[model samples]
Target: MRRLSGVTIDCAEPAVLAGFWSALLDRPVSAEHARPDWATVGSRFDPAPRLTFQRVPEPKRGKVRLHLDVEVDDIDEARARIEELGGRWTGERHDYPGEGVVLGMTDPEGHEFCVVQYF
Candidate 1:
């Protein structure tokens, strides 16, 4: 069986983007894996797959089709914290009576992600 390795994100600034993810995930950026054009957060020894960032010449142009969903204990708190980290709420929210709540947000660079809270 093949195991999923890690997810790599393309961004204009690898280290900066990695910093955002590192803080959000509470994972340290791997100094050993950092370079001028690349940066990584989390370690191979960790059970979760590491996140890597690669430098790209072009800026993000349209809406991202694939986005990350960050599960949190409190959606409002998480949204506020994300905004403190240079992210912003996108005014998109959904709620299910007994299921959960999902709020769309964007990173400093405008990458979209969701903050989810389940009841």
Candidate 2:
């Protein structure tokens, strides 16, 4: 069986990025890492997926090949909260009516992620 372990994001400041993601996910930062160059955040439950932030010297230049898909109870409310947390809403797709909605957003560092809602 295959299971997701964690996802790493490149940033100039690992602690700062990790704080943002930790707040968004409502989880605590990892205790394993005690360095400013690298930080991880996730829950203590089963199948916990860590969001690792690593320090990089240069800024992101191209499009990201991978992005996160977060499940939210309400799409509109989640989008608003994300925006307040330094996330920018890119767009939304409404293909399946009353089923689900996908809102594209970017992090403070311009990493694209999606917020999905299912009814």
Candidate 3:
């Protein structure tokens, strides 16, 4: 059997980025792994794969080829909270009428992700 371990995000400040994700996901940043150059959310014991942030030398240059999709019960509320946590709404929204809504968003450092609300 095979399983996924974690997703590593490259950034300039691991701790700060980790903090943002921790707040957004309502998961505690692992105290054991928190550091200037690296930080993580979730642990081996958690069912979900960990979210790891690592310091990188270069700034992000272009649109991310892949991104996270965060599911929420209410997209508007989620958007407000995400902004409070230092994330930004990209002004790109998609609505599927009877299905759901998807909003483009970016983390504090501009890494893209999506906030989704399903009917």
Candidate 4:
């Protein structure tokens, strides 16, 4: 059996990226696993994998294939909150009647993610 341990993100600033993700996920950054160049967040009763951030020297060149999908109760509120936290709405939205809505957004580090709300 394959046990999914964690997902590591290559970033320029570990603490900053970790902080953005931590607030968005409503979880605390794991101090024990954090370092000057690496930081971890999320892992409390959540069956999903944890998130780790590692410091990298190079900037992201192209688009990211793997990004996060954050589910929230309200898309508008979440968008506002994300914007308040330095993230921005990408002006792209998708709607599925009787299903849900997906709002595209970019994090402080320019990583794209989605805020989803299901009916």
Give RMSD to native, each candidate. 1.2, 2.0, 1.2, 1.7
Candidate 2 lDDT over residue span 1-119, tens digit each: 56777777999878877877888889888865677699989743437777888898999988899899999999889888888888899875654787888888888888889999998
Tell me, by TM-score, which candidate is best: 3
Which stretches of candidate 1 lie above 4 Å from their native place?
none
Ordered list by lDDT, greatest first: 3, 1, 4, 2
**lDDT, each prediction:** 0.88, 0.83, 0.92, 0.87
Q: Which segments of candidate 2 are over 4 A away from where they belong?
A: 43-46
Worst 10 residues of 1 by lDDT: 1-10
Which candidate leads in lDDT? 3
lDDT of 4 by residue, 29-118 (tens): 887574799898876345777888898899987889988899999999999999988899999999999999999999888888899999
Q: Compute the lDDT of residue 100 as modeled in candidate 4.
A: 100
Better of 3 and 4 by TM-score: 3
Model 4 scores worst on lDDT over the 10 consecutive residues at 41-50
C-alpha positional error of residue 117 in candidate 4 after TM-score superposition, expressed in Å: 0.3
lDDT score at residue 35, model 3, on the 0-100 scale: 67
Cα lDDT tens digits, model 3, 1-119, are 46776899999989889889999999989965656788998885788888999998999999989999999999999999999999999999999999999999999999999999999
TM-score of each: 0.94, 0.88, 0.94, 0.91
Q: Count clashing residue pairs per candidate.
A: 0, 0, 0, 0
Write the number of the candidate with greater TM-score, choosing between 2 and 3: 3
Per-residue lDDT of 1-119 in model 1, one digit per residue for the tens? 55766888889888888888889989999975757999998876778888888888998999978988999999999999999988999999999899999999998889999999999
